[model samples]
Target: MTTAFSLAPLFRSSVGFDRFNDLFESAARNDSASGYPPYNVEKLAEDKYRIVIAVAGFQEQELDLQVEKGVLTVAGGKRDNGAQNQEKDNVTYLHQGIAERAFKLSFRLADHIEVRNAGLANGLLTIDLLRQIPEEAKAKRIPINGQQVLEREGS
Candidate 1:
C-alpha cells in the first residue's frame, strides 16, 4: 500500500523550498523497471557521504556520472563496439543469469552538495560527495550595537 503525505506543514515555515518539495514528489512517483545494480549510501562524516554501486560487468569507460541542477546521475552500460558485437553474435547462453543491461540512477542533492570523486574497482563504483558550505553562506552571529537602558515614566 502506498501512502500519500501532505507537505503543507513543511512549507509553512520554509522559504524557497518548492524545489525540495518537487524532489520529494518526483522520488515517490518514480518506479524503475529494474533495480539492476544494487547500491549503498553511507555517511562517512557529518558532511561527507559515499555511494557504492555494484557494477559487476561494467567497465570504467562504460560508466558515466554527472551532476545537473542539484541532481546527481550515475549511469552504466556496455558500449557497442564492432569487436564486442561480433563476439556477442557467436555466443549463445543456455541460461542467461548475468545482466548486461544499461541502468541510470539519480539522486536529488540538497544545496551545496558536491561530488568530490568517483572510482571504479573490483566491480564496484564508488562516488564520494561533500557538502561544502561557502564562507558567506555559513552562519554568523551579528553583534548588537549600543545597549541603552530605558526607564518608564510610571516606573
Candidate 2:
C-alpha cells in the first residue's frame, strides 16, 4: 500500500497548531511496515522516550535510521533465505516453532522532539527520544492578574 495510516486530520483542523499539524502529516509517510519484526515504545521521563525493537538477525549495515520532518523511521532487511536452501538445510519439520524475518518500523514524534541516540546490544535495538517543552507549555505563576491582582508592592 502506498499509505497505511495518518495523523494529519487531528492537527490540521485546529488553529495555532501549524507546527504540530505538519509533524503529524509527515508521520503518515515515514515508514510503512509489513510486520516482520516487532517493537515497543516506552516513556523514560517526562519528556524522554525510547523505542526498543527486536532485530535479532539484522546487522548494522542492513539497518537504517532516519528522521523525516518529525517522524522517526527504522528499517532493516536480512540476507535472503531462498526456498531452494530451506529444504536442504532442514531435515524435517514437525511444527515450525520459530520465525526469523526482516522488518521496518516508524515512529511519529511531537514538535521539537529529537533523537538522542540509538544503539544495538543484546539483540535489541534501542532508540532514545527527547522532547523539549515549549515555553508556552510550561507552568508559571498567573501574576495575580485582574481583580485578583495584589496591591502595590510599595504599599
Candidate 3:
C-alpha cells in the first residue's frame, strides 16, 4: 500500500516553487512505471554527478540521451538482430528475465547543470554531469561607498 501526499500545504508557504510542485505530482502519478532499467546516481564532487544505468542487452546505437530546458532524457530500445529473426522458429526460452522492451526515463536538472559526457561499457551506461555556476551568480563582496552630502538651506 502506498500513502498519498498532498502538496497544498507546501504551496501556502513556498513561493516560486510551482515547478517543484508539478514535478512531485507527476512523479507520484508515474511511480508505477519506474521499475525497469535500474540506475544509480552518485555525487563524485561538489558540483559533479554521475548516473549509471544497467543496459545489459542494449547497444550503443540503440541508446539515446538528450537534455532540453533543464530536463534530461534517456531512452533505449532493442534492435532486431539478424540471427534472432532467422532462427525464430528454432529458438525457445523456458524463462526469460532480461528485459528487451523499449523504455524512456527522464530527470529534472537544476539550473546550470550540464551533461558533460556519456559512455557505455560492460553493460553499464554512465552519464557525467557538471554544475557550472556563472561568475555573476557566485557570492562576492559588495563594495560600500561611504559619502556624506550636505543639504542646502530651505528655498
Candidate 4:
C-alpha cells in the first residue's frame, strides 16, 4: 500500500480564517476582472471616498448599479453603435487602445459603507463612496480617573 497524502492540513488552516476566509475565498472566484470598466478608488476628503469608472461606450440607460447584501455591483451592456462606428477611422497607427467591449465589475463593500452618488461625465463614470459611521465605531474617548473602582464578581 502507498503512503497517504495529507489534505487535512488544508482544511485546518481554512478553519482558522472563519468569516474572513470565506470572504477572501469567495472573492478569488470572481476577482479575475478587477480592472474592468477602468475604475479608481480614492479618498476625496477626510471622511469621503470616490469610485470613478471610465465607460466610454456605455450609456446611462444601459448601465445598472445595485447594492445587495453589502456588495456594489455595476454592470453594463454595449449601447447600440451610437454613431461611433460611423466615425471609426482605422487610419494612422499612433495608438489605438480603448476597447469597444461590454463588461461588468463588482466591488465588495464593508458594513456602513454606501454608494453616495454616481454620474457619467464625458467618457468617465464616477461612483462616490461614503462610509456612514456607526455609533459604536465612531471616535469616542473614555474618561479615566486614577482611582480604584469597585469590581463585582459573577453572581
- For residues 98-150, what per-residue lDDT tens digits would candidate 4 score against the true structure? 66576777666766777888998998888887777789888899789998676
User: If the candidates were sorted by their TM-score against the true structure, best first, what order would they fall in?
Assistant: 3, 1, 4, 2
For TM-score, the strongest prediction is 3
Tens digits of per-residue lDDT, candidate 2, 1-155, equal: 59766554333212222466455654444444434466666777777877788887667777899999766778786555588458647767787644545565666566677898999987788988887778998788856545845577898
Error of 4 at 16 (Å): 24
Candidate 3 per-residue lDDT over residues 1-155, each given as its tens digit: 99997764333211222467666565556655466788877778888888888988888999999988777889999777788767864768898788767888777777778899999999999999888989999999967677645567893
lDDT scores in order: 0.76, 0.66, 0.76, 0.67
Supply every candidate's count of residue pairs whose N, Cα or C atoms clash at under 3 angstroms: 0, 0, 0, 0
Native-referenced Cα lDDT, model 1: 0.76
C-alpha lDDT (0 to 100) for residue 38 of candidate 1? 77
Prediction 4 global C-alpha lDDT: 0.67
Worst lDDT window (10 residues) for model 4?
Answer: 9-18
TM-score per prediction, in order, is: 0.73, 0.58, 0.75, 0.64
Candidate 2 runs further than 4 Å off: 1-34, 79-100, 134-140, 146-155
